[model samples]
Target: MRTAYSVETVRAAERELIARLPEGALMQRAAAGLAAVCAGLLRKVYGARVVLLVGPGDNGGDALYAGARLARRGAGVTAVAMDPERIHEGGLRALLAAGGRLADGVPARADLVLDGLVGIGGRGGLRPAAAALVERIPAGAVVVAVDLPSGVDADTGEVAGAAVRADVTVTFGAYKPGLLIDPGASRAGAVRLVDIGLSLPEPEVEALQDAEVGALLPVPTASSDKYRRGVVGVVAGSAQYPGAAVLAVSGALRGGAGAVRYVGPAVDAVLARYPETLIGRGRVQAWVIGPGLGTGRAAEVAEVLADPVPVLVDADGLRGLDPAVLRGRPAPTLLTPHAGEAAALLGVSREEVEAARLTSVRALAAKYGAVALLKGSTTLVSAAGGPVRVNPTGTPWLATAGSGDVLSGLTGSLLAAGLDAVDAASVGAYLHGLAARRAASGAPLLAQHIAESLPEAWRQHP
Candidate 1:
């Protein structure tokens, strides 16, 4: 699993390492890693022009020491100190000793820029000088952030003000929550972890690994039969939006469910796309309700939800769900909601949901007595009173329309295939993201194209 540590946890781990090691050891390790990454960013060490946006804290120390390494390697290195007086004395000496230049003004042209303006110790937005430096770096200059970009909240993933945008972010110790979440995550670009000998305990937040996903996937043995595997009944899409049914069914068919049973106005459309699907449901192991089913179609929604099987409620089903009905359900239920829908369910704004994604997903699970998957840049899945699973594999390209519908169907199908709610959500999200990444190849891709890439996603593992 790719585990992320909070700033507090990282500080604690840093402290532990500091106490045991000799002076400057940890910073040297961090600087070495940072310098190595800087070299990789340029793709060559010699004749490269590199600029360091230095601040006062140890963050600036990291950059200065790293710049000294680059300077010795034949890169033209310049340090633009935002806080000259508070800069790391030792680091500054090292840079000057290595023939690195100090410039009061920003460089007119540079191959790469290093953002050392802020680290986990920083709070709120960037100071004016740092912000100005961030703004001055023109396009085409690859920005590499040391620890984190200047104006991002290291703990909450919130960009309180103007933040430095990086092409690649090299973070120390462990992954920070900001690197995994949106807004801050959006600014983080591609993240790389550099271990600084800080041994941390169990992380509070984590992303699932391939082995974890493989273990969680619903795999049936030779002894398994259709009914033995599990049946997934879907109540999705109306005549008005039949595509939801088709897409949902497409994912369900790809998922491990033994059979997919459809019951909705879009039954004809579902049959047309997936002729193998059973048109009318008899018995179902799990139910996936919502998708394109309209908000006012609660009566039909309620009937399917009434079934004593694990249910995944998404899209329109999220609207107007009876709390009493949710409170009384015996079987497991999983609610998949994006920020907007989560906001509606929590009686808060979308910004509120985005601000506290981890808290929001878990709170929604507790409120509804169901597993909740808050879909976004970092899809969070939480079962009430259980460990939250954060999925970090999705591409921005997965933001295409109808993607959520496919995710809901796939998750519900996993549940039908006999995995628990938490497992189903995590596994489905991993597959959905892997498929999108495979399909997109860094280019724009449609939801259907993502759905079509499921086989390649499955083939990635044994």
Candidate 2:
């Protein structure tokens, strides 16, 4: 699992380590790690044109010390400090001694630009001076940020103002929550964690790695029969939109479910593509309700919720969701909602939910007392009183019709296969996104293509 800590946790860990180490030892360690990453990013360190954008505080000091290291190695390094008088004296002296000079203006073009303008302490947007310099950066110049991209909220992943967009971010000590969630995540192109020995407790957020997901995946043994593997029940699709049934069934078919029992009005539509589907409902371990069941299916929704099985409520089922009913379920309940559906459930605008995705996801989970997967640019799965799961794999091509329906089926199958609510949601989102990326390649792909690519996705497990 890829775990990320909040700014508060990171600071506490840093404080503990700094108190035990010699004066300036911790900063040096961070600077060294930062320099190593910078050196690797540059094709050849020697003669490389490196420009450091310096701000006040320890962030500027890190860049200055790192700049000094590169300058001593025969690279052309310059430090453009936003506040010259406030720069770290030790770091400034080190840079000057190593042949690095303070520049009056930004360089026209450089091999790389180190953004140390803002750190985790920064609140909103970039300062005018820093923003102006960032605007002039050459298009092709590789931008490497120290710790995190300037202007991003380290805790909330919110970009309130103009932020530096980095090609690669060399974060010190631990991963910040901002680095794992969007729109801050989008600004941080690629993240590299540099260990400085800051001991941290449980992370604020986590993204499952392939190895961890592989361990959680259920693979049957010789003793396992079809019934033993697990059976998933899908109740979806309306007469008006029978294709939803086909797409949902397609995803369930690929998921590791032993048998799929579907109950809906689109029986002919589902059977045409998936002949093996058992029509109507029998005993099931879990149920997926509403892909295109649409409105006016209150009784159907009620019937599924009454069953003592892990349930995934999605699409139309999420429209009139009552927290009381969900809390009453004997088994775990998973709620999958796109931004719009989530917004509806919370009685908020879609834009509001999108802007504060982290808060929105957590709120949804707490309110419903269930595992909530908020699907969007970044798929977030949150359980009540727990850190949200950030799905690392996905493509923009996944925003297609019936995509969520496919995800519902896949996740329902996992639930039936004995995964918990959180695991089923996170793992399902990860696989769903990966399959879409594989199916799309570089061009457009239909929702069916994503379903078709699941076996290939499973093959890609590390």
Candidate 3:
């Protein structure tokens, strides 16, 4: 699994490592790694033009030292200093000795631009000068950010103002929460971690890798029967949106559930698509409620909640949800809500929820006493108190309708298969996102396509 640390923890780790190493040794290690990546990106360092946007901190020093290395290799490297007085003395001297020159402004043309404008310590967004310089970067340039993109919160992934949009970001030590979550994740187009040998504690957030997912997936044994595998009950869809039932059932069928007992008004539509569906309520290991069951399905929701089985609530089911109903439940429960739904549940605007996704999801989980999955640019799963699981695999194409219903069904099946609410939600989101990426392949795709692609995704993971 790929893990992410909070800014405070990362800073402490870096400090501890720095203290253990010789003076300037840690910086040299960072610079060496940075320079190596730059060399690789440049292909032939000789005669290549590289621009370094140097700020007034250690990040700038790292870039300056890297520029010195590139200069020695015969590259025409220019360091655009954001603050001349505060430049690293050692780094500046090295660059000058290696024939690198300081420039007032960026050159007209350059193959690469290293954004060392701000480090993890930076707050809010880019300062005026930095933001102006970032805007001047040529479109063709491959912008590689140092540590992380400038103007992003290393801890929260929040971007208050203008930020560097890098083609790739080479981070040191370990991953930060910002690098895995968005809008910082999006700003950091592609992230590569450079080892700086800092021993750290448990991460603040985590993304499960394929190996972990494969191990967690419920596999059948030779002696296992249909009942033993697990049964998932889906209470979703309404007359208004019969397609939701079809899609939810579509996902449940592929969700490793031994049998799917669907109870809703869209029974005919679901049966037409998945003929093997058990048609009505039965003894199920878990229940997935509220996906297009428009209002008026309160009785169905109550019945599912009354049962001792694990339950997943989503979409229309989240509307006017009573937190009291979910308090101190015997069985585990998961709530899947998109930004709009989450905003309504929290009595806040969608923008507020989007701005603080981690907090909102955690708050929802605590308030309702269930695992909450906030679905958006970054699908986050949070329980009452623990590190949020940030899903890594996804595509913008998943914005299509009916996607949540499919995810609800998928996660509910995992819950039935004996995984807890946290694991169930996280794994389901990962596979669901992976399926969308596979199905879309950069083109428009319907929600059904994602459901259809789940088997391929499941097999690929295992």
Q: What are the RMSD figures for all models against the true structure?
A: 2.3, 1.2, 1.2
Q: What lDDT score belongs to each candidate, Candidate 1 first? A: 0.87, 0.91, 0.90
Off by over 4 Å in 3: none
Which has the better lDDT: candidate 1, or candidate 3? 3
Candidate 2 lDDT over 84-113, as tens digits, reads 888888999999999999988888879999
lDDT of 2 at 195: 92
lDDT of 1: 0.87
lDDT comparing candidate 3 with the true structure = 0.90
Residue pairs clashing, model 1? none
lDDT of 3 by residue, 1-462 (tens): 999998799889888988998999888888999999989998999999899999999999899898999999999988888877887789989998999999899888999999999999998899998998898887798899999999988988889899999988989889988988888999998888889998998888999989988888888889888799899999888889888888888888888878899998898898888899998878999999888889887877888899998999988887777888888579988999999999999999999898878779888998998889999999999988878899998999999998888898899888888888899998899999999999999999999999999999999976
| lDDT (Cα, 0-100) at 204 in candidate 2 | 82
| Candidate 2 lDDT trough over 10 residues, lowest sum | 132-141
The candidate with the higher TM-score, 1 or 2, is 2
Highest lDDT: which candidate? 2
Ranking by TM-score: 2, 3, 1
Q: Number of backbone collisions per candidate, in order?
A: 0, 0, 0
- Candidate 1 lDDT, 321-428, residue by residue in tens: 766788798998899999999999989999989877877987898888888999998898887774577887888899988998889888889999989888899889
The full ranking of all candidates by lDDT, starting with the best, is 2, 3, 1
